[model samples]
Target: MLCGKSLVNNFYKYKRKVWQNVIPIIKRHNATYHPPKILFFGTDNFSLPSLQALHRNCSDRLGVVTSFKSPANCVRSYAEKEKLPLKKWPIEPSDCSQFDLGVVVSFGHMIPANIINGFPNGMINVHASLLPKWRGAAPIMYAIMKGDASTGVSIMKIEPHRFDIGAILAQREVVIKPDVFMPELHASLALLGADLLVDTVNNVQERLKEAKLQDNTNASYAPKITNKLTEVVWSELSAFDIYTRYRALFGYKNLTTSFLGKQVQLLELRIPERELLVQEPGTFKYQKQRKSLLIGCAQDSQLEILQLRVEGRKPMNAQDFNNGFLKGARSLNFTQNKLSAN
Candidate 1:
């Protein structure tokens, strides 16, 4: 009886081992079943880099769609240069019957609903912000403007006529450093988006099944930047706020202020160590010892100008600008012509 019991136990153990091996084989087969076709959309510098990276990595399964007009004209230029076969169409073209899935990075215009729904697998957008937080035009700039300690890239589904309200596929967080500028941040986010995109595509089935909806309550819009928005409001803002504004609008537009009946561009700025109790907001105070151009703000902190430009003049340091323009002038003016022309 004891020998018979031992034989039964061994037989049960052997059966369990066989089932364990078979289950993993079944799962592996399931995992290898399908790979979706992907379409890339965009034409700006940011989009171009990500698209190029995606094509290089997933050339066999990716297609590209871009605009045939100005601003997004680089799409055509890159396609010709790289010999990439691209489908060029106007922003609201009537037909989009080609792709199974779409991925938009920095496509300037809003994609119509028909084109978005044409993809059976659905479209995904790689936004530069954490989503539900910074949505709309300039997320990167908005994040920097808000002085966020950290920001991330989100891989979200494309929903028609909505602003970042789709389900999220994945997100990769990036830490914001004090010295990191806009160009560096932009590049980093683009690369992160490309990587996250590839991973999302690879795991589409599972991610789609487990997608999470974004919270609309936390949503905020980042409007498109303009010259008017770039004007420095010294009377209402602090030095740190001004500093962040400068970094956020750098490369795209220069921050402007009034000086001697002309708009003086605030090229580079820093916080002064010594506080001045006597200066009023928008007052220009020079620190020749530190070679700094100090502009007073609403708060105790001051904006130390490193470089600036006057109307019809090249950008110069505070000392050089002071020596040439600000010395003899009384109150400078921030005119529409002086601010917008450059």
Candidate 2:
């Protein structure tokens, strides 16, 4: 039989073990007990997930600040529907001081120093690309265009005037699948940014304490997409290059070239499984049996163009295009240069 003192000692040991196991769970619960007051700056559908997450997890999401160009006013519409406070862009400094932190995602404007200073914890941005790489408005598009094998999201401090040069608070990487297109990549990165943003916000002060300054020297930029990028240079671009560019611009823009003096938009492109006989780049061979158009490209590569649209006409499959446009021409070729009207 145990003595009273032994019984007391055994009870204390059991109590200590139970507390050891319970303390971490209690700490985790307490960590989120007091949600911070947050002012969210965002625009576009890409920013929606993060906003929704913060609203669901935090009690004090003060309001949303967005630009006039909110991609069909998606963010604004969501804010209004949810009855969340919504403010137009160029938020006043006077109104910002009450927030504990500012979270910016795809906001499209640089927050002024005064506005950033207004928040007790300053402002942090959720960028779509890994810091020091593809830092700008169209990171996802650029990542696809450049054939990057991997891309990611970064939670960083927002510096005035400059963009994507902020100190990184956290980063998360994702693989770029060979066949992934713009919308898929964009959605993946958006969700990743949202997940990382929530974690950073939950322990923002500690994260800020350990923030790492970005290495500007090693940085690369992803500028806005322009029409000029859609023009395909068949001679200079490989099948992979054209296909990747098509994937990158999918749903945003179409790969365009000049076909027999007419503007032709390559609607659907693919890398051909088998190589074609060495031919001059920009020249195409219509495979009547397969109903596919094979365009010669750099380094003996060939691109299979399945769908296309001639300027002033509706989109059509290769078979229809060949039957109507080709008219049984012996040799047909595409060119990058738009021919001058005679």
Candidate 3:
């Protein structure tokens, strides 16, 4: 009896695993009975390329809804330039009842529950990171900053009044190289997202059967990017941390630090092997031999400056910055007296 019970338990476990793997595929297959008329919503450079791809590939069936003239606007401008059928609406309009599916790609705004429930097929979100892990704004940057080995895109069903809690229709893993920068990674993920989206839409029912529910217990939050997070805390972080910060904010935002009573933004940085004993953490050390600006960190590591921009000066290499700007720049003193005075 004991042996028989053990065998039955093992068989059930295996079946459970198979069921978990097969369910989403079955759901997606069932969902694809009708060719979905999609509304693509997003406004950002990241979303622009995907919009272009969808426009070129799925033009007959896809419509676009995007933000107005904002810093992050992507689809509206593209629609205007290409003269494509586009609607600028933060909320779903009265005529939105015609759309079958809502596919959101890098749309910054949090869609309301009413709009999510309006569609018969259901809304879908193309999240940058694997779901239930990095679910919120700035997933790519946060993933890099946290030094994740791999991140992926998730195609999830948007449920009413929920945040990233929908069933995942499909996902594709993306391996991060040690040397990959933020811009390149973002572009690669965006393209990958587009492909996954198309596949999910084409095989909707089969993919939905394979869709998996994320573990609520393991859920983590990715808050929106803020100026405070962009500021460099040199005294509390190591050189490697600083380097990651630089990469995370590159192009979109800058890693800012104060120097000589002026704020300087570091656009890029490298790490050198050579050690310096004199300069304190957060202080700048000029290496005449290597012509590098070695900035001391909270840890023993030294940050080799590659490119930097001063408060009012143009961006330049460490050597050029030293010669042109730092020649007259005073050393920042983070002492109590300096803090009190400032």
Candidate 4:
């Protein structure tokens, strides 16, 4: 038994470990039922765990269906490892009809209506957000990018028409922390979705009655993320806002902030505890003595740029980047590329 001091220490130490322990919950569901004859539809790492959970817990699997896309070839590796049947895209309705059920997780493509009707039980999807919210591609990143305080995973029956517009089967909510980045959040939700998926399969008959129709009235779409959204309009955003955006977008994609037309790639940044004087937003202020870089934002907040890449230069830390260009400069006008030697 942990004493008071050790108890507090363990709590801090295992706080993240606690989240990592969701695999057991999935394992528990395995024993309760025979594996459903599932045809899994997925292509990326996000779908990997759910397929694994199904392979472990459920038997009589039909196979895995995937596109031969790069960057998300985990499905193929997994199928080979498990010695499971693997089928590529343009799948026919006949292929889907052989399974007792269908499961989709981050599959990134729609299951056609012909395939939908083939399953006697129809299809179930493990979506990363609660129904009617973040109901599209890129839910994990969008939740963080929009600064949502809490987001969740939802297991829903698939509608033939679209993605994530179905009735809710189950949901598990997680609070967002300022420090949690996109990859961390993505991983957590994947495991959570797996747990929910197995539970939904076991309780589908009973759970369907409890399934709530989504309130389309409150629906907000999380559009697919592209390079265009990576553009940081510094003057229009707050430090806190940009910080959240950067956190969500950085690990998985490039984050570039441009002034007028010139782009600067940010390798890293941090929000410090110290406050700065109010200044016009988007002003870059550097301290030569302290070897610091501070950029002003809305609400008088400051963003400390720790690492950045100027054009025609390699990435550098604040102390190093300041050496040649920003040593004596106080403030630089980003638009005109003018130094405040005035």
Candidate 5:
């Protein structure tokens, strides 16, 4: 027979043994076992989803860090609205030393070595593309422009001096629907990135331990969008190429060309099923039934110009444009001008 004190001692020993075995399992699988203190860095609307996710998952969110070059920084607005702490860029290393980790999304600034070393767990970035593929400032734009079949989000460590050259901690891929345009794709990728970021940060240590280096041989770049890409080279680009460019540049810039000695912007465009009678690229014929302009393009392809705006004029539908400007004009042509013809 066991004494009372002896029985209590045995029971405690058994409980301790059980817990010791279970603790490792719990830590391995539990996402919120020990939420890390996070310092978030972001500036644009694209960064909002990640910050919002971290706030929901982490109880120890320290603050937001951003260098606000634009007047409309959504991250700054969000931190203010939430009454969370906010720190401008170029923060001192000592200030963020207490934080366990740093999260960057669309921050657009190179973090210094001292600042990256402040966090005990180091910094991770939520990039909008599957890294090594489109690694630069405008991954989303280039992905849409290049008409890739698929794209995804990448969670990676932040290496100093370079943009997006980091070991990937995690990644999640999404399909690019055939008819999907830039704004829709951008929104979808942003939300997907946010979810992946939360999951990665939840088990960051394990993810970091299992990080994989990107294959530079298979790497590609997405340079910043420029005004030159918006120009419509009618003689050089196929109708499909023009339509793809329009889809990619939607909500960013419209395709521009010179029409009848004036600069004209192609606002709304569609791919035409049947070719027009005109064979020369850039020539157009107004389709009476369709209420659109069938414009010739390279490789015998044709595009429907649904809406356009001539220089110093309000945007008009194809019907209105034809009625107002193309009255009695059939063989009007769009030209590649050497200078601004406005």
Candidate 6:
């Protein structure tokens, strides 16, 4: 009923339903445009693309501030290669105040209020998920694990104490395909964020004014990835659910299960179209002609093993692994391997 006149306002309200591409807040910045002196913060490959974008756009990039802990990585290497001035974090607010604006990406440290307010233009973050959702460490991984249809990068101005809860300047989404994995999604978002960041920085003043407040009510946290979360519980979660998590956390956190008395990396898990007779969940069934291992799961789903890595060994085709390891065995239980170890 009220969507026409206040579409912008309504888009802010119903952010999830609408593919709201928050068009640049068009307003005249009658004053001459001066490229901002940006203080860039980042620590890894995820932050590299955005840093490169800033360097290409802004002439006076103050320096790179990265984690002292993650030194000698991509950010440091890139800075040295390009001869961009670089410094380690735990830097003083007064020092950060020198720059006209602060840009952060994949920099794990929280910028204190003084540093955030230090920049005359303001500090901005290029986050991997849409604001008010997946607002934590591993948004990309969580989005895939949770089986979200789509997720996007968010550009938002920073505030004290609260993390990722700020006025969103811009957002651009990427659709999740049925078979998308970690590296593909990560690279896509990194590039998308870099491009979006360039557009936002080119019009800092208008974006600040147009930045919309995030709805706290709809906010969801993507807690940091942990070892425990990577352990596959075949009986508790269905084949599809486990497959999705395997897709999401593969590179960073290998989905592992003790199989045949060895820790095996589940590189790929896919549910076949044809259903099989009911069997105990987590029991493996070998098909000689197909050269595949069919693992029964909840909801009558069976996981076809495509790829895997045996502990202390390189990844290989699951068929080869089945022939080599399974031998004459038809099926094995998850607990079978665990019990043997104990």
User: Can you write out model 4's per-residue Cα lDDT over 27-61, one digit (the tens) per residue?
Assistant: 87655556558889988888998988888777445
- All candidates in order of TM-score, best leading: 2, 5, 6, 4, 1, 3
Candidate 5 structure quality by residue, lDDT tens digits, 78-101:
888888888888799987887899
Worst 10 residues of 6 by lDDT: 22-31
Please, what are the lDDT tens digits per residue for candidate 3 over residues 140-233? Answer: 8888888889998998988766668888999899898766778989999999988888878877767777888888888777778887777766
Model 3 Cα shift for residue 302 (angstroms)? 0.5
Model 2 gets an lDDT of 0.87
The Cα error of candidate 3 at residue 177, in Å, is 0.9
- Tell me the whole-model lDDT of each prediction, alpha carbons only: 0.78, 0.87, 0.77, 0.79, 0.87, 0.82
lDDT of 4 at 318: 75
Please give the RMSD to the true structure for each candidate, in Å.
Answer: 6.1, 4.3, 9.2, 9.6, 7.2, 9.5
Per-residue error at 55 for model 2, in Å?
A: 0.9
Query: Candidate 6: which pairs clash?
Result: none
In model 2, which runs have C-alpha deviations exceeding 4 angstroms?
1-28, 69-71, 328-331, 337-342
Tens-place lDDT per residue, model 2, 1-342, is 469889999999999999999999999988857667888988888999999889887855558888776368778888888988888888799778778999999988878999998988999999999989998889999999999999999999988889999899999999999999999999988998988899999899899999999888899999999878888888888889989999999999888898767798889888867776666898887888768988889888888889999999999999998889788665598987573221
Backbone clashes counted, model 3 = 23
TM-score per candidate: 0.83, 0.90, 0.81, 0.83, 0.87, 0.84
The residue-by-residue lDDT of candidate 6 on 109-218, one tens digit each, is: 87888888888988999999988899999999999989999999999998888778889999998898989998899999999999999999988889999999999999
1 or 2, which is superior by lDDT?
Answer: 2
